[model samples]
Target chain A: MKVKLAKNYGFCFGVRRAIKLAESKPNGITLGPLIHNAKEIERLKENFNVVVNENIQEIPKDSEVIIRTHGIPKQDLELLKQKTKNITDATCPFVTKPQEICEKMSAEGYQIIIFGDEKHPEVKGVMSYCKNTPLVIEDLMALKNSKIQEKVALISQTTKNIESFLQIVDFLVRNCAECRVFNTICNATFDNQESARNLAKEVDIMIIVGGKNSSNTKQLYNISKEYCKDCYLIEDYLELRKSWFDGKKLCGVSAGASTPNWIIDKVVQDIEKL
Target chain B: MKVKLAKNYGFCFGVRRAIKLAESKPNGITLGPLIHNAKEIERLKENFNVVVNENIQEIPKDSEVIIRTHGIPKQDLELLKQKTKNITDATCPFVTKPQEICEKMSAEGYQIIIFGDEKHPEVKGVMSYCKNTPLVIEDLMALKNSKIQEKVALISQTTKNIESFLQIVDFLVRNCAECRVFNTICNATFDNQESARNLAKEVDIMIIVGGKNSSNTKQLYNISKEYCKDCYLIEDYLELRKSWFDGKKLCGVSAGASTPNWIIDKVVQDIEKL
Candidate 1:
């Protein structure tokens, strides 16, 4: 089987920036996994001596702590401020934009509507900034059913699709008397998904490598699966099945933002041997 | 045939207020017809000696000018200010609310979407307040097709139906990221339409009495027609067809904001004879 790599794959700008920040603070403890990918986090822990801990209170006082790319909720950030004097903020600026926007709009008496997965850490971080309970909608149908106020402001998580975001914007403009919309879908997620979709169209089987918990990786897999029927999401070469490559004429490879290049190369070399 | 009059009909609050204001300055020249109904305008001209002039330039300098219920464009209002020192602002406060809202929202960099007839005087007046060109959408389809902005504000002509207005509001809230809406549908129009709709449901035939040019009157006729198929819109008893009452068990009579109570009574009495 012939294998083709997606044009834009592997670590995105924000992810690279975050990993670099974590590497610089060699002895630091990240508030969460430095990134979503377990393999990448393990490498950081082993090579840079960086520890991963979810709870702020568990970390020793005055020790260096790094905020992850997904960002932390306001309460957690406040706790971190009090607990740690040596702080390394690696929160993606793209994620920071929506958080700031939600805070400003909610203060101005606008009912906030968020178009993002509610359970996602990035979405949770952004939602904490709003003064009132925001109507968190993951799909167009939920947005259609949401109760409206006289004034509303809408924003989205960094990893959401642009088309769905614009669709929600269009619906709100036609329904609300006055609306404010911000297109906060980060460029890296958009490009990666687009590249994966494009590659999937020409391949008989598609392989998307990333952590199962990574939002952008799951999105890439979902997008690729739409164009290619035989699509698989695996974290490393160990999970890859030889049966997937059987009788497949062409295969496409793509990786999520948190996926390290070394893991992708190993997966590619193993697929070539099959 | 049995004739039943709508409980709430004829001479709406805004129209009554405007007429009362015109009556106080009996000798002044109204910028336009003080109200939509021609018969009422003629009565005001003949009895109160108030003349109706469409052109601001035609009126003599320093002459008393009534602004009328529908209000005037901003430029005309400016002209009136310069040309005449004695100006009576008879513009309905309900109509004025939308105008002020459009101006304020447009100033705050919001695209204004008005749910109203584009050619309507009230809509025109509201549009004049906006610095940028406002999107005047009359129906749900037109509103759905309108291009959206990051921020949007919606207002309505005072005579628009509350149902359609709310539907538009719901659609906008679902689509726009941020939206601001003001239900500027005047109370008089809402009550009149509701009364007409209620009366039409009980009657076999309906008579809507008002000038053809009156927006609220047309709305009442449309609303009554939906519930009663044999609905007829007439200015007076002269236009009421006797054939409409043929084999009809009951007849309903309703009037618009500009329709005089005397006209409604005459139409009711004429229908009773039929």
Candidate 2:
């Protein structure tokens, strides 16, 4: 069995902690599929004996709960805390920073604005840190209509594009009288985009690594797709068809945050065999 | 009459509409500076202006309300409408469209991600359109952290930087599993930026026209400043110093969306006089 692992392959700090917490759980429900990888999620399901991230339709008093790597909205977390007897937190620390910044800004009487999807688990988790409802405006037109009194504060989710954040900040500078902004995009994401972009420039074919549902993995593919003509996003070695690699010379690989070292290694080895 | 008229004088579409509506109001309470230009604002105040953007404490219930050219937040508009018996809305139509798109997306369950600022009037206006609490994550880190579960929709403010917007969207396209984005940065804005960039290359001195407070005007300066050795943002003829024209054989003049034709003409006249 030949195999090569992605440089970024394996459980990231957050994912590893989440999986570890699940294993240590005496008894609890696993919030939403813990990670995107089906195999990993399946393994966790088998161990913790819990369901995916679903609303509590039925709950027994004092039932333990385990939060996933992607955190929950403030309301959901609060509601969960209120209803549950014990909660095991597994959200990433990097993910929590934006929320903290936003909350601090809101406390100081600044109109808090967040940049990202309003409904994303990460956005919700970040927003949860805020004291009040954040004004989530997604485009310049909405920005043209944003009603900040005197001062405004801005923040973003970690996985967001850096260029987008600067654009938004520039827009704010152009539109508003007074504004404050925080650049909280993660360093890892920057490395991924920069590396992917550089790799895309040199490679003929860019094979992105990660599950289909993984957002970060999709991002790597998208960045690579812009520069390279042939870029395919795949989950694992099993998904790679023999013919897809036909006549391919140089290939670049990238993965999502949740991917493990073993799977990345396996996919690379399989591709090497091809 | 020291009323030195600029060749590029009078209100641009946004300011014109805002001024006309405010003038139509024989009554009270101006929502914002009718225009960023102090002279124009002074004239409005002398006639029928009562400013209330970041400064006003309380507005009477029955006062006539006028919105400015830069656009106001949706919530503020709503509150004003409720407070005033007669309302005179004068927002520029060009600046209004992006807000509509953002609001619609927010209502539809898409993540409202703006490519612009959190405090900009345009962004604030757009923020108001969000059905739920929206976010304004700026930069790759913010977007990376955003990882919202639902779809993300992005739009740019009319006068934003094209390169910046695309970079952000590029990040968005990669990271987001599914996204719908609109290049809402206005046509005039693109033309202005393109024109300025192109002119910056050939001109010895690039004189940017519009108010210091004007966002687009500043962007024009930034763009021109890049290619040209001498690029100055001039508010009017009065701001033109003799030193700017000291031995300059050729000069280029460009105006912002809010800059009047008379201002550009005055600047040109000043350059000629030098």
Candidate 3:
């Protein structure tokens, strides 16, 4: 059986920059674990003395604080900067756009309606950018709690489903007299989804490659599962259970952004052996 | 021609909440336009006194501050609260999930990765929730900038395409050693998209009902367009030109969440007339 791997899959620019930054300096402390994969963290730990800083205050004074690719909150960044002059900011440019939008919408006095997962770190960071106590809701009833008005500024978390974002936007537009929406979902994000959808259509057994803790990876698993019943998630060659691919002839491989090219190669090689 | 409407069509809960809040009392002040719809905003102006407060300092103290279904950044909200005590929040619950994720990630020392349009209000709100500087990416570059090992969290701005969100997630898991993620897309959102996809398959002409400024409506238009070339977006009966009836037999109508029932009814009537 041949293994087909997605060409555009793996760690993105921001993630690369972050990893390079971590590897650039032998001495650095990560706020927590960097990325979602366990194997990668172990590798990084061997090269650099990376420690998870749970308490901001507990961080060594003037320690080289490298903001992860996902980025720390604005306040945290400010605090890091204040504490240490040496701060490496690896925040993605796309992420910064949401901050600017919140500042603009909140300043305009529009009821800031953010459509996103309330528990995700990215959502939390975007929330800090607001100028007012922006009301947030996931469903219809919760949306009702927000004061209805002619002016509502709508936005989505960068990773939100575009279709879902539109539904939320539609809801706000229908109920509110005036709704201003900015399509904040990343362009690459959308393309990745489109590609996955297209790929899923052609595959019999889909294998999503990513860390279990990775949000995007989990979403990939879920999406592939919807189309391909044999879809399953595994981190690397080690996790590839031979049992799942009993007599599987065709397997489509797709990896999360954080995934390294080396790992993708390894997975393909392992699948070929199977 | 006979017209059939979608079961889950029309103004969603968030839109209704925002509109109701705007039109509510004898005294009301919106931070900006209630929604993006021009007609609806015009209607709101007729019924209520809508005001835009762009300059944070310009807001009068003790004013009744109303939050739109589109959320604001956390910092802006704090600044607004500092100026006024009374706030009417009208936001959807699904939208708030990203905020929670940001907060949790920040507290736990994970970097926050947001997937959505960075410029959108929803993304902004999620950033604020983190109270930290987050890396917001709309594309695969986000994976490069995500958390490493022990500290990365991923989330989507609600209203995002589930397919898109999953691709980004998949990237994270494959590369990142340790990451946490949440599939925050609302249930109603998926249902709407699925319905549209299904309808597009069986209809000769599909009519999308909602405001031009509505994102979900546009998405619906895009979906229908993919399957049927004759998909039309109508804010109300006014936009439904007679050309739409060129040789259509069965027409499918789907409204956005923010579209009022009246608007859908008017469109339905117009289709019937056609």
Best by DockQ: 1
- What digit string (tens of lDDT, one per residue) describes model 2 on residues B86-181? 776677787677777777777778777776667677777777877876667555567677656446777777678877766675565445544455
Q: Which regions of candidate 2 are displaced past 4 Å? A: A1-10, A48-50, A137-150, B1-274
List model 2 lDDT by residue over A167-210, tens digit each: 67666644543345565666566677777778788776777777
CAPRI quality band, candidate 3: incorrect
Model 2 chain B TM at 0.85
Residue B124 accuracy (lDDT) in model 2: 78
| Candidate order (TM-score) | 1, 2, 3
lDDT of 1 by residue, A186-266 (tens): 878878988998999999999999999998899998899999999999999999998888889889999999999999999
lDDT for B144 (candidate 2): 72
- Each candidate's interface RMSD (Å, one decimal) is 7.0, 11.2, 14.1
Superposed on the true chain A, the predicted chain A of model 3 yields a TM-score of: 0.89
RMSD of each: 6.7, 13.5, 15.8
Off by over 4 Å in 3: A137-149, B1-274
Kindly list the per-residue Cα lDDT of model 3 for residues A75-133, writing each as its tens digit.
Answer: 87777777888676656556677767887878988777777666656666777878777
